[model samples]
Target: MDNFLQVLLDGVLNGLVYALVAAGLSLIWGVMDVINFAHGEFLMVGMYVSYWLGFILKIDPLFSWVAAGLFLFILGAVTYKIIIRNSLGKSGMAPLLATFGLSMVLKNFCMNRFTPNFRLLSGTILEGKTLSFGGAIISVPQLVTALFALVVLSLLYWMLKKTRLGWAIQATAMDKEAAELMGIKTENIFLLVFGIGGACVGITGGLMTSYLAVYPEVGGLFSLIAFVVVALGGFGSIPGALLAALLIGLVESFSGFYIAAVVKYVAVFAVYLAVILLRPRGLFGW
Candidate 1:
């Protein structure tokens, strides 16, 4: 029972991270109708940004997260304005192909610059701290990351529910043509949403770097998981994404413990398939 509880708690912690990543993916898809294949690359960019700031600039990893997120936000906005905007109406294969090309470019660029070697960011903040609750042991970094995720998720929820720009985003997502007819600048909204989405990915990347190794291919792995998350939660559904992320996180944690570690992802995939089979639109999809 103790082991089970520990695994469950760990799963929830990991799920929160996955939720953060999935939220960004869902936001971009919901608002812009463009699936960003480079979503993970944005994460990779964040990790690298935090890595440099923490290692070279001698900044705290937490502080570096803010810097990385802001930088990625700008990057995302620019990418949207320069590349995504051009492929707005041409959604069939052009955007997909273009983004795929962009992903390849990012991968190669990272490979050239950072290489495929794994990198770790070391700092006093994240070393040698653990919290024990009953039989469960939680690390300080994981706790901080989870708390950060909760705070950010709450703020995002509030923004979407209570703010004007949030309303614009929702309206645009619901009906782009109608939103434009109602004087909403759909293009600008897309840009903002893309930026915000990227910012989320950036933050996730920074947080992940504290716990996971940094590699050029890290983005691709996370991107694939994000895709599954979005699909499992329902495309363009924020709440759905959160819920799905939690589910996947828990499954991954428990499966890895009771089953084979290599099969954890397979378990997640199976869950996704089962959910899709049962509800084609997704659990919380409208």
Candidate 2:
């Protein structure tokens, strides 16, 4: 029973982090209908930003994450103005290809600049700390990351549901022509949405630095899992992302424990396949 509880707790914490990572991708997909193949690179950059800040200034990730988020926000907005804007409304796979190319550029840039070696952060505020409950032991950094993720997600929900900007975002997403007719600047909305999405992943990367190693290729697996979470949760649905993330987290955790660690991801993809096969529209997709 204790072991079961430990696995369950681990799964939930991992799920929350996954949720935060997927939220930005979900928002971008929902609002712009643009699949950002470079989304993972955005995360990689943010991790680097956090790592450099800590290494140079001795600042903790708790504070450096804000800088990472801000940097990624600007990067996202710039990418939109330069690359994505040109591909908008174009026929064929221009938008998709544009992002894919951007992803390649960012990945190789990191490889050349940062090298392929993995870097781990140490001596941060939450490093080497743990909390024990009953028989289960939880890492402090993981707990903080999970709690902060939940808070950020809740705030995002409130922004979308209670703010005028949220209404404008939704309207633009639903029909760009109609939103433009109603005096909503669809272009500005798209820029902001992209920036917000970037910030989401950026913050996630910063938080994860306390516990995970950073590398050029680190985002690849996470990117794939995030794509699954966004599709499974229904594109553009925050609640859906959270639900799907938790489900995947649990499946991965339990399978790694009971089956084989190497095959845990196979179980995750199997569940994703089964769910999509049954409901092609996704759990919450319209």
Candidate 3:
């Protein structure tokens, strides 16, 4: 029971981070119908940013998340302007292929610059810290990351539900032509949405730096899981993404503990396949 409790806690913590990453993917997919194959690469880039800041400037990742977010926002906007915008209204494969190419470029660039060696940030404020609750021993970094995810998810939900900007985003997503006719400037909204998506993953990357190692190829696994989360939760649904992430987290933890660590991912995908087979639209997809 104690071991179960510990695994539960770990699953929830990991789920929260996965939700944060998936939320961005959901947003981009919901709004632009773009898969953003480069989403994981964006996360990888954000991790590097935090690592360098901590390595050279002695700034903690907690303090550098905002900077990482801002940088990725710029990168996203530039990507839209330079590449994605041109592909709009073309074949659906265009954007997908574009992002796939982007992912390759980013992976190769990071490999060339940082090499394939894994790098872990050290001496952060949360390093070597743990908190005990009943039978569960929790890492402080994981706790903090979970809390951060909650706050960001709340804010994102609120923004989408209450703010004018969010309304504009929704309008654009629903009908781009109609939105443009209504003076929504869907192009600008698309740009902003992409930026916001990038920022979400960027912030997540920074938060995760305290516990996870950084490597050029690290984003692939995350990106794959995020795609699964988005699809499972239903595209364009934040709440769906959250629930799906938590489900994946729990499955991963339990399967890894009881079954086998190697087959944990297989279990996750099996669940996904089952759910997808039943509901082609996903849990919350319209």
Q: What TM-score, over all chains together, does every model reach?
A: 0.96, 0.98, 0.98
- Report RMSD (Å) for each prediction in the order shown: 1.2, 0.9, 0.8
Candidate 3 at residue 134, lDDT? Answer: 87
Error of 2 at 43 (Å): 0.9
Task: Report lDDT (Cα) of residue 238, candidate 2.
Answer: 92
By lDDT, the better pick of 1 and 2 is 2
Model 3: how far is 85 from its true place, Å?
A: 0.5
- Per-residue lDDT tens digits for candidate 2, residues 132-192, read 9889999999999888889888988888889999999999989999999999999999999
Model 3 reaches what TM-score against the true structure?
0.98
lDDT agreement with native, every candidate: 0.85, 0.91, 0.92
Worst 10 residues of 1 by lDDT: 120-129
Which candidate, 1 or 2, has the higher TM-score?
Answer: 2
Query: Where in model 2 is the C-alpha error above 4 Å?
Result: none
List the lowest-lDDT window of 10 residues for candidate 2. 87-96
Task: State each candidate's clash count.
Answer: 0, 0, 0
lDDT of 2: 0.91
Best by lDDT: 3
Clashes of 3: 0
